[model samples]
Target: MGRKRKTKIFMIMIAFVLFLAGCNFNSSESSNEETGGSEGETKQVLNISTTADIPTLDSTKAHDGIAFTVLNNVNEGLYRQDENNEPIEALVTEHKENEDKTVHTFTLRDSNWSNGDPVTAQDFEYAWKRVMKDASPYNFMFVTAGIKNSEAIMNEEMDTEDLGIKAIDEKTVEVTLEAANPLFQSLMTFPTFLPQNQKFVEEQGDQYALEAENVLFNGPFTLVDWTHEQGWKYEKNEDYWDADAVKLDAINAYVVKDPAAGINLYETNKVDRIVLSSEAVDQNKDDENFDTILEPEILFLRFNHNHPVLGNKNIRQAVNMAIDKKSLTDVILKNGSTPLDGIVPKGFFKSPAGEDFRDINGDFNTGTVEEAQKVWETGLKEAGVEEVNVSINIADSEDHKKVAEYIQAQLEDNLPGFKLNIKAVPFAQRLEIEKAIDYDLSLSSWGPDYSDPMTYLDMWLEGGSANRMDYSNAKLEELVASARTETDLEKRYQMLLDTEKILLEEDAAIAPLYQDGTAVLMRSKIKNLLVHPTGASFSYKWVTIEE
Candidate 1:
């Protein structure tokens, strides 16, 4: 559902990179005769920009927002989020659940992939089990969703065939969960759960999804051209089950890392949308088309617990306290971003008592530099060292680099002998290094995979897929484990509340920097484009262009 809130600032540092990328689309070629629009005749074309390239198109391996946004448009899932952000059936026409709600059966409507292959229930079963077998970066989603035997399957304790999913018939798919999960249907909307054609995938092997032609599409649009580091094109899929609902005939997306270049494209009418950086925001704030969205994405500092210097709780707490979050958000990140002292962003969740999670949990590590110095000195004594030198790995984007530099300066200035070396690398490479646990600190971000708090809380579990920080806390782990199956709303809510307390205030496991806000300029003609707070970022199924 659209929770479009207007704010003063425009643009997201991390999400900006996800949504804009390079393209060679000619502006003159965008308009063409297309049928079906509120206006008798319309251009029926939408051009946009993103800063980073899609890492991979394969749904199984897609871990970044860039890949998720692209895959979500080109592929259909059992369920999809509606404009209101609620789960609605997509490929599935009907669904039934058993009394205990551990088992779910879905009946599909007729659909075909871009290659004219029938989309069957077997595809869903195949794709899901394949994620487990391959140990995808998002494999833990199955376990968090409470899928039956998913934990064992991911851990190699059980065969993937034993997973709680099967194709009962040509159009019927069934799933069994270890416990009744209320978010199961919503989880179906996530990109990680999208179905894949088994035959086509096996045929292409490693080449599958590496290029536009190698992939098959069953959603509203099919990716027709992908020029590696350049841009890509999406053409309307006539065979889509709900093609009639898709208004745009084509969408041309490009990679434009430079804000000035993106603004130039927008000014020249070459592109319909462009996200502004902080500097650009000041120049464009007076424009009528300027808009902003407070996304449910949080950028935070991840501490590698395996590192000897970082493993010290005092050091981690000092790191969290040394930096001035208010200054970072107000000055450096002036695009409506808010300083976040808690891991969970505001407005994302409410307790059983109807209180906002952030309101109830309050803030952590909002102390002054003097307090940070005290903690840093204590940490130095405990570690038997005079000073500490650690590197922070970050995405190689202008915005991220600026933020990392600010953090480096803050730690060095406020924490006495602390020295922070920033290692800037491509986004995809940064993810790889973090996954291998090779970095001391990492500037990372997390967007909700689902609406539940577990999406953020579960990652810190002893061996959770996203626990690249190597953090382990028995109390936090116990709370998450119990909350997963705790049916009582009040009790479950309390467990989660306590979990955040232990994570931030008690353990200082990670330092939360800010919650992102997206500022962009969009052509007034573009209508009905859905920007989701979680799962896939954007949906173009109902987008339209005016005459």
Candidate 2:
């Protein structure tokens, strides 16, 4: 997930993967994880399924909130944007600001608790200070870094008060920003800034958050049951302040990725929705439930610049220009994955002139064994080396393995003296290995940060967390820093372009491949279900069932 910028958005995003009662994999019951059910009757359950198992629920430990909170309306932030992308109050009743934009205040909406108590501003205060104090790494803390002394507080230099949040009363809260962020209200729409009950969390200890009874939520739903391998389930939380608006009575989410099985479940009407493969699309294109969406997920190869051979631009570029993106898109991801040109995916940020990024005309000299060989030959000659043995790491999934296999064939064909080896591991495990730069080459995926160009462009900066490449460029770092503060949208975009140019076209530390829209097969009965631009899981809330 390239959600570094959306740290605030995903701070509250955690895990919740469930299985079924029949298969222990299809049950998707609610727990400490999962969401989505019918409105009036407890018998009406929406059995949903997915392809990947959630990683973990610890926000500080896991990036994606699997086993935690991909969906479920019980948790909420200060503000939330509606279908029109308009920012509106969620838990907060009103937002007040000073004339100078230096001070901000919020009035809570009398948000309720599962135990019938009023949700108060203290909840937000506790959650905020806790994350900063504990080094929660929820990314939301970073958004507040612009606040006075926030960075220092996160680094333990000052107390929580200096960190900039105050609960004046049971319903009132105040915050001071380092600078006026016009998007601040929209920023509050993220889960990171949401209120977490201090009373409830303190009582549970470490294990409290791992189950339903250990936590309290003020959202539209409540956690019912959760067990290992059995998917979580959720029912309506009638005590919520805005319970009347909630349409779903319960939501069943199953964590299984087998496309064939998922399709079968959908066919049997056991699943309300599922994700299909390119092959499945070909077969189900005519089915009524067949609806495909182009989502924000992008796939690419991250060079372990920490590796010996990866330090060279030539070798990196040879590998970068080698893979056939068109083949990957047209053949593998028939779900409309646009082949990338520069680091930023096409249409990451559109301009009056068109998209803000670059494209190599659907042909970046990738995919051809001959081109790879030529670049490799020159790279080897420049390094004064006759042979280079490299290992390419990939996720163990079938789709990922196919990608690795194709690239291996290309590398072997292009450079006879160079040996290409495959290092395959589970998706999450591969991420750990890649983070440590344990391989010469690794392929991975990233969704966006915000709806900004900086999300894709800033990752390659020196010392950036996402910069597993161990890549450093003085000029690149300068550009990234400047872009963050530029504020001028157009100028900021140009800064991103320059950064991408240096990282992809010039340094070649990373290879661009495909950007795709996620594909979803959903029950036509599922209405008001809006898949966010961020990714697939930021769903469940803001959705209603018609029947």
Q: How many clashes (backbone N, Cα, C below 3 Å) per candidate?
A: 17, 39
* Alpha-carbon runs more than 4 Å astray in model 2: 1-19, 22-44, 59-62, 65-72, 115-117, 137-141, 152-161, 212-214, 352-369, 381-390, 417-424
**lDDT tens digits, residue span 1-547, model 1:** 3334222113343333344333444452434543334555666889889888789999999998999999989999999889998999999889999999999999999999998999999999999999999899999999888999998987789999999999999899999999999899899999999999999999999999999999899999999888876688898999999999998888888887777668866876768999888888888998999987888999999999988889989999999999888888888877889989998899999887789998988899878889889999999899888899999999888789889999999999998888889999888899999899999999999999988788889889887779998898999988998999999999999999899999998899999999998789998999999999889999999998874
Off by over 4 Å in 1: 1-24, 28-40
Give Cα distance to truth, residue 519, candidate 1, Å: 1.3
Task: Quote each prediction's TM-score.
Answer: 0.94, 0.84
TM accuracy, model 1: 0.94
lDDT of each: 0.88, 0.65
The lDDT, on a scale of 0 to 1, for candidate 1 is 0.88
Please provide, for model 2 over 244-312, each residue's C-alpha lDDT reduced to its tens digit, 9 standing for 90 to 100. 776666776665545666666676566788877767878877777777666566778887766656677
lDDT score of residue 518 within candidate 2: 49
Q: Judging by lDDT against the true structure, name the best candidate.
A: 1
